[model samples]
Target: MESENVDMNIIPPQIAGGAMDAVEKRFFETEAEAKTFFENTSKRLLSVNEWGKYAGMSSFQLMDAHGIRADRTAEPGDFIRIDIPGPGTHAGMGYDWVRVKEIKELSNHEEQISYIIVQPCSHPMDKDGAIAHFFKDDATSTFIIRKFGLVVSAEEHGRNEIPNTDHGKFLDKSRNFVVGMAAKVGLSYPQWKNLVKGLLQN
Candidate 1:
């Protein structure tokens, strides 16, 4: 399919419905611009799963189809990022890392796995400081609003690049596209930078 052209300068109506308004004030000159961008983005048919691939998890579904379990997938201390309260709401649209504290198999649901997670209260305002329980299937699948996946790092930037391929240019374009959509929803470029800095530091 041909990619839809979007105007990054306009904000969509959806921004007013979320936590993005907080940061939108800092980056966008006016709310109207943010609205225009978001309205255009809404016309695009990108699903949450396709968008989540950029955050990592490009091959999770394939791996799952082959019957791989969490024991062979993720390990403790590995950062698993998830979106709480999901999309199309006033909830914040940010991926917060919850490190795996423990991994256990479910007796009730065969082959299903769960992870005990500890969210780092890196910031003073973080209220989800307590350990939380997350299911591996819930985290990987995007049949619902929330999708948890592996965290992509700057270190893995060119690991999949083919020799002589202009992968960096394509990656930059992809990054800019997502950033544009994120900014419309209130995760301005500055806020995203801050969020990534926190992720890398922690």
Candidate 2:
């Protein structure tokens, strides 16, 4: 079997610089098995809600997540709704929303790669509402699945930007401060790591 590197050019600099980065990989005995697993795993990666099942085994679980497709096609305009349990929920701040910015696929005789990239965005239901988004638009989360020879890898790559809003100039300093502090203290890495593990689980 031939060995080749998964393309890293798909990752933008902003996401590459993200504060939280996590990755996980699984190896298969045969390239055919790896290809089969890649197809199933890619679907799971795109179905954001199913993440809970895989991450549930970890102490830090992804409690709630949903994907809102723009159309039946499941393209770039879709949205992901994520609820992070904490003060934000207690205060009725609402869930975090990220827009699907890109869905890319690349392939050759020896390899196949697929990824979805999302960036923080205003809540789709209430764009002008008072709900404070936890991350700035500059922040991104990329979910990737790559098949190379007899190995498969799943990756989550993105940067966390300070919390801000796209709807208005009103900034929630208190909430942003808390989230910023959490990001700095490395509160999100474990969750992301578990999420990546969930992606590669058998």
Could you say which candidate leads in lDDT?
Answer: 2
lDDT of each: 0.25, 0.64
lDDT of 1 by residue, 13-110 (tens): 22121222111111234556543433332222122123233333211111121222232344444443344323211111133233434333222211
What number of clashing residue pairs does each candidate have, in the order they appear? Answer: 13, 1
Look at candidate 1 and tell me the lDDT of residue 38. Answer: 33
* Model 1, TM vs. native: 0.19
Best by TM-score: 2
Q: Assess candidate 1 and give its lDDT.
A: 0.25
Clashes of 2: 1
Deviation of model 1 at 1, angstroms: 43
Give the Å shift of residue 116 in candidate 1: 5.6
Deviation in Å, model 1, residue 58 alpha carbon:
13
TM-score of each: 0.19, 0.76
